[model samples]
Target: MNRLFVMMAVLLAGMSAYAQSEKRIYTKAERKSAEERKFQKRMETVMDSINYADAVKALEELDFVLEADRLVFKRGETAFVTSNTNFISLSDDNAVVQIAPFNGGGPNGVGGITVEGRASNIKMKTDKKGNITFSMSVMGAGISATVDLSLPKGTNRASVTVNPNLNSNRITLGGYLLPKERSSVFKGTSF
Candidate 1:
């Protein structure tokens, strides 16, 4: 009886080991999809708390446009000054936006200029009619701009304008951002 019980325990341990090994590891595609889903879910929850009307109201309190220029040395006697002007808008959801770089000004042009930055923990929500609203904490720059946006109904596409004050840094007029649909923005280009 002792011998039989020992053999039974060994067999059970082997079966458990096999079961553990059979557990599936997620493929790269599956992992990416899961991550995307989590991000979307988080965005939805954040958006739910947005108030589009108040966002619009706040825009009235802002200066509406800000311009800044900086001087930089190139190589030889030629120096260039880069000037940027931001037109901003606010949504009830809490989004800070900058005008998208256009044909001559985007990163694709020769002697291209790119300004890369990030804002942390901005909030947003869409109205029942599909108007989005949001706020943002401008990072790196000492100033933050608030906006109100009137987005198109039935779609996520909207025109944004921002007005920032650089009174703090006396240089960078900063604000939040609301991203447009990546697919639409990246159309005809490899993203």
Candidate 2:
């Protein structure tokens, strides 16, 4: 009778240990799954906020304005551009302003005859006129083109002057691009 009692006690102790180990394993898996679910929710919410059509429209209008001066644009062609992205977010008042450069390939099929011009001496500043001046000198194909864009509230004016080198081919650009909408895509959750 004494031997039976001792054996039963040992069995009960082993069962308790097994039960605790199983509970720990399940708790860890549940925690991991909950985290995964939270991440998925944030991702879906972000994907829904992008409006590509609005971005394309904005670029088209800006292009039309640039075109009035006879400057032609080609996708992956005529001119590649880089800009400092200034984001205005209402959620984070103290967020640091991000400066990002935009890279573009000018017209894809290049005839060495159609070398794309590069912008240098680029400057942008606001004046007392509540207007901003965007100025740059473009040089390529043995030619130089200088452009100054004066953007006033509700009005933007550009002064473009070109000097073509001897044997230089005239270049024109045409395209619809949505470079300004890059910020609309959310790559990850921001705190």
Candidate 3:
């Protein structure tokens, strides 16, 4: 009986030791990769703070690009598009609105129409909570439209609704607002 008890104790101790040894141990490369990811995340947080401030400044100056990666129509159809081909840009007294419903080749060489016009009736308002309402009428040779933009507080994301004077199809562009210098959007031919 004493021998059986001793054998059981020895077995339990050996099992416990084996279990501890099976713990996952990261290699040197994995440890370095984890530390690098942590550092990258911290850097992105700091950069986002600075970028947010710059976006606010650009909004005040009326010089920013709102790249519309998502397109929504009044008939309830929504599409996710590439930012390079679909964007609404405002610079001083001029506003350019482009919509490429499809990818690859078409009109404006980006599969859609690009309209640039002189912006008038520019009404920019900001409430106490930092929300913004910017509306303007864009009139050109053949384009007559009203562009209304809304930016919520504490974030650079924005939604712009474009209403054409002659059409019932309302289009809204949803995306982030970025400073002009930081904007990587490519502008196609405009009418």
Candidate 4:
């Protein structure tokens, strides 16, 4: 009787071990699905790395365009604007800031004012975790403003604040900062 009981215990243990091992074996469809998922994950990682590098290069070179998806005012008011017509671009020391929100027409024949200025007192900083902060004073034909831009780690999305030197009202732009080649912004006539 003891021998039979010992044999039964050994059999049960073997069955359980087999069951666990069997769970790891994938069917043909399951294996293919897993492979595809792994491939997608790898591609996403590679793409993210490339985008992060591009953003870093754009910022360091001071040649980038910021397409504002939303315009935020100091009073907490927000307005959605067309990216192509409303953008802030900085290339070398030249900065062009435009805000055009019209389906028909407004200012500059597009919607709003397009101010082209010279960026000065430029300051750029990068943190250990790969975040960047940039600030400069822009003085031009119609506006004198200080622009502060922040870019988070591993992404091209940015928030930039434009504070005019002589006004209490400030505008913040939330958008993506991209190299000029990747940017799809349209320039309106400068005011």
Candidate 5:
């Protein structure tokens, strides 16, 4: 009876040891790769579920106003609202531009600075992923600016690059171009 008891105890101990050893230790790289694979799979599923045709149609019908948040200049970044009150409204045919200091705010902000322009010679293209690219010449106030804008489908965000003929520096702005319904509440509100 003692021998039988000892054999059973040995078997249980061995089984416990084997169970503990079954756990595998993963390296940091291996874990990261596994996470990346999971992320890719999730992205793939999301991409597949999206209706590309609908997205393209929505982008083609885009018409909204983009309010500038930040203005990137050669000197540095500045609060767009501080020295500028600018908004770009884009539709299928024309882009209406409104800028602050309507005169020409001289090189040092002494003159009557104008920021108004109208988009002409507009060219628009779209990619397979429903990203729209628009290039146009905005001419006004005896000055011209090349405006390049990108709008992604099914999103409220847009990116704009404005290269004015008078300045060597290019200004880039990013902001939301939400529908009129979404932007109305924020009208007359300042930050």
Candidate 6:
């Protein structure tokens, strides 16, 4: 019985020593690197909460154009615009603008019909902080759309809000706007 007790005590001691030795000890440099990584992660989180107006100010300071050749949506199809004229054309069936003229007399008016050509007006405005507001009116189709964008400095990503004067639905589309150089890459390709 005495010998058995001695063996048990020795075994327990050995196990305790083994467990203590298993603990990892980091070097000073390794500890510093870990701390730096944690600090960087925190900084990124704080940066994401920055105000949009401030971000637009930074873009303005950099003299950046908020308009892109292509406006890519997160859920819907992408829209491509001409660089010089901003003329956009989609397929015949899925065209954004549709026009029809009414000729018959209604409760309000006359039998004469007025026809207007397919003319569109575009107005673009930018604030001092580089935030952009674009409005398009298709007089022939009686369609009006306005887009407000908040752009960050040195980044292609933007927060966009689109309001169409059809019914009363406003859509929030958050996505990246491809730069001029990257726009060419997607020009011929179907995304």
List residue ranges in candidate 4 displaced over 4 A: 1-38
For model 1 the local lDDT of residue 45 reads 56
Candidate 3 vs candidate 6: which has greater TM-score? 3
- For model 3, the local distance difference test gives 0.86
| TM-score of candidate 1 on Cα atoms, chains taken together | 0.29
Overall lDDT per candidate, in order of appearance:
0.38, 0.36, 0.86, 0.88, 0.59, 0.41
Model 2 RMSD, rounded to 1 decimal: 19.8
Q: Considering every candidate listed, which one attains the maximal lDDT?
A: 4
Tens digit per residue, CA lDDT, model 1, 54-161: 333333333222221222122223222222333333223322333333435443241233232244345556688756554455433323543223444333233332
Residue 170: error of model 4 in Å?
Answer: 1.2
Q: What is the model-wide C-alpha lDDT for candidate 1?
A: 0.38
What value of lDDT does candidate 5 attain over all alpha carbons?
0.59
Scored by TM-score, the top model is: 4
Shift of residue 175 alpha carbon in model 1, Å: 19
The lowest-lDDT stretch of 10 consecutive residues in candidate 4 is: 100-109
Model 3 Cα displacement at 133 (Å)? 1.3
Candidate 6 yields a Cα-based lDDT of 0.41
CA error at residue 13 for candidate 4, angstroms: 16
Write one digit per residue (lDDT tens) for candidate 5, span 65-136.
Answer: 566555555566654442234555555544544444233354324232334456677777978976778777
Q: Assess candidate 2 and give its TM-score to the true structure.
A: 0.28
